[model samples]
Target: MTVQPIIFFPDQRLKQICAPVIEFDNALRTLTVDLLDTLRAAPGIGITAPHIGINQRVVLLDLPQSNMPEIYINPEITWLSDNKKQNEEGSISMPGISAPVERSVTIRFCYTDLYGKEHTEEADGLRSICLQHEIDQLNGIFWIQRLSALRRTRLLTRYKNI
Candidate 1:
C-alpha cells in the first residue's frame, strides 16, 4: 500500500508529456499498485503516472461503477464520436477545483494491459469522460485546459482560495 505523493497543479511536470512504458516488469506492476493507492488516497476516480512525477504513460481508473480498477499503459484514443457531452471534470492534481467540460460522447481507445496485452475498448457516459481525461493528462494536457478562458480563470481563483 504505497500511496505516492501527487504533484499538484501549476507544476510544470504536469504539463510535460510522459514517455511510453517499455518494460512490463515488476517495476511497472509496482508503479501501478502505487498509483492505485495514491488514487484511493486522493479519493479520485482516475489518475496517471505523471501525477506522481513518474512521467510514464500509465493510467489507473477505478470508477464508482467499476467492479475493479483498470490499468491502461500507453493508452491512446483511437476514435471519437461527433456527438459531445458536458460533464463536471476535475483532477487529483488540483483538488477542490471542478468545472463542467465538454467532451466526446463516445470514445474508442487502445491500451496495453499490465501483462503487455494490447486491448481496445469503447466507452460512453462517465467512463468515456474519464478515459479522455486521463489520456489528456498522459499527453500533458491538464483537465482545466479544456475549459473556456473565462471559466478557467474563475476556477483558478476558486482553487487559489482553497
Candidate 2:
C-alpha cells in the first residue's frame, strides 16, 4: 500500500458520512496500510479513513510516535470528561487556519484493530483531541464546522484570501 494524498476542504468526499466497516479482511487490511502510509507521508499524527473517500469507519493515528502507530477501526467514543481543555485546532482538510477551542479532557474509546480484536481505552490531552478530530471526520464534519457563525464566516472570507 502507498500513501494517498489527503483530501482538501470543499472536497465533497470529505463531507460524506462513512459506513461501518463490515469485514476484517484484505481490503480492510490494505486500507489500514494505506492510511498508515498516507499519515506518515502527510507527516501527520492522525487521519480518518473516510477522509480519503473510502467511507469506512477507521482512523490512522501515530501521535508523533517514531515507530508505533495506532490504527483504530470503527471507533466510538464511549465516555468523556466533564472538564474541558482549550487547544489550537486545525486540520489538513481545512488548511491555513487555526483556532483555539475547548474540548473534553478525557475520552474513552472503543474500536477494532487490524486483527479483528476489540480494544478499549481512555485518552487525554492531545490524544483525546486527535481521537475526537478523527471521529468528526467520520461524521462528515470539520473543525471549522464547529465554529460560530461569525468565526466560520470570517474563516470562509479568509479562505477567499483576505
Task: Write candidate 2's Cα lDDT for 35-98 as tens digits.
Answer: 8888777667788886676888899888864368888888999998999988888876666777
Tens-digit lDDT string for candidate 1 (32-151): 999999999999999999999998999999999999998999999999999998999999999888899999999999999999999999999988999999999989999999999999
Alpha carbon lDDT of residue 5, candidate 2?
Answer: 72
In model 2, the Cα lDDT at residue 15 comes to 82
Q: Taking the candidates one at a time, how many backbone clashes does each contain?
A: 0, 0
What TM-score would candidate 1 get against the native?
Answer: 0.98
* Model 1 misplaced regions, further than 4 Å: none
RMSD after CA superposition, every candidate = 0.7, 1.7
Model 2 spans > 4 angstroms off: 65-67
Q: In model 1, what is the error at residue 44, expressed in angstroms?
A: 0.8
